[model samples]
Target: MRVLVVDDERGLTGALRRGLTAEGFAVDVAHDGDTGLDLATDRDYDAIVLDVMLPRRNGYDVVTALRAAGVTTPVLMLSAKDGEHDVADGLDVGADDYLTKPFSFVVLVARIRALLRRPPQVRPAVLAAGDLVLDPAARTVTRAGVPVDLTTRELALLEYLMRHADRVVGKVELRDHVWDGPGEDGNVVEVYVGYLRRKLGRDAVVTVRGAGYRVAG
Candidate 1:
């Protein structure tokens, strides 16, 4: 799963990044709210860990903007203020859950998992194409009733393709969404596509020739 962590504290963000990464999540961190807002809007994240007190924009405003822009991706607000009003405000603005600072990392992970499991208004729980099946929450993929072992990148790539099955998705589009950022080499997308084709079968993903790729609908 992919998660975005938005906090102003460097130590906290770094620790969370390392911990979440170890727990099988592709985590992106932002020191301030502006960067967080941009990333949250541009990329698809399963869940967001947002700090209530942020620079540029507060967590409440950020969540409000996300909801206004129709980004239904779940958000878990993190704050030092553990008062009745603070908690209520976060939820009222659109946060799905809230965690107080100096919080347990285990609890945070559990909350994130819970958010990911909740039904998303914008995305499906599972994606399927042809004989392939992918469960995003479970992070499992199977083709023709047989399990397929895929690396994190491979699974992310397949999920993105399957979500847009039947449509030609450009390499740049895939890189922007599936990858953290542009790779050092431009052939990264090609390399991963090759990996997917090998595992899922060549006929699973179709090349549009000079344009991009499409998964069988």
Candidate 2:
């Protein structure tokens, strides 16, 4: 799953990014609320970890703006304050859940999983294409009920492609989302696509010539 963590505390954000990535999540971090809001608006994220005290915009304003703009992505608001009003205000402004600072990593993970499983618009816990099954939370992939081993980058690439199954996703698009930043060469996408095709089968991912690639639906 993809997650956006918005916090100005560099240490906290860095730790969360590392921890969440290790947990098999594709994570993106934003130091301030404006950047967070922009990222949330432009991209589709499974969940967001938003800090209440942010630069330029506060967590409440950010969530309110997102809701006003019709972004229903689940948000887990974070704050150092543990007061009743603080938690209630966060929920009242459309936060799906709230967490206090100095929180346990295990608890945070649990809360995120609970949010992902919430009713009405819950996303599938496992993503599938043809006979291939990918468990995002477990970071496991199986084909025809047999396990398939993949590197971190390979798993990330496959997850992004599978999320947009059957769509012609451009290399630039893949580079932007799957990769960490613009410093990565465009050829990396092709290299990883080749790797996925080999593991999943040549017919698994289709090349659109100069366009891009598409995973069979």
lDDT of each: 0.86, 0.87
Give residue 32's lDDT in candidate 1 (0 to 100): 86
For model 1, residues 51-120, the per-residue Cα lDDT tens digits are 9999999999999999999999999999999999999999999999999988999899888877865756
What does candidate 2's lDDT look like per residue over 1-217, in tens digits? 6789999999999999998877656689999999999999999787899999999999999999999999999999999999999999999999999999889998998898778767435567788988888886687998889898998888878877887785898888787667654677769988998998888888878999989998876
| Pairs with backbone N, CA or C atoms under 3 Å apart (clashes), candidate 1 | none
After superposing candidate 1 on the true structure, give the runs of residues whose Cα lies further than 4 Å from its correct spot.
Answer: 1-3, 18-28, 38-47, 68-73, 82-84, 102-121
Candidate 2: worst 10 consecutive residues by lDDT?
Answer: 116-125
- Residue 44's lDDT in candidate 1: 81
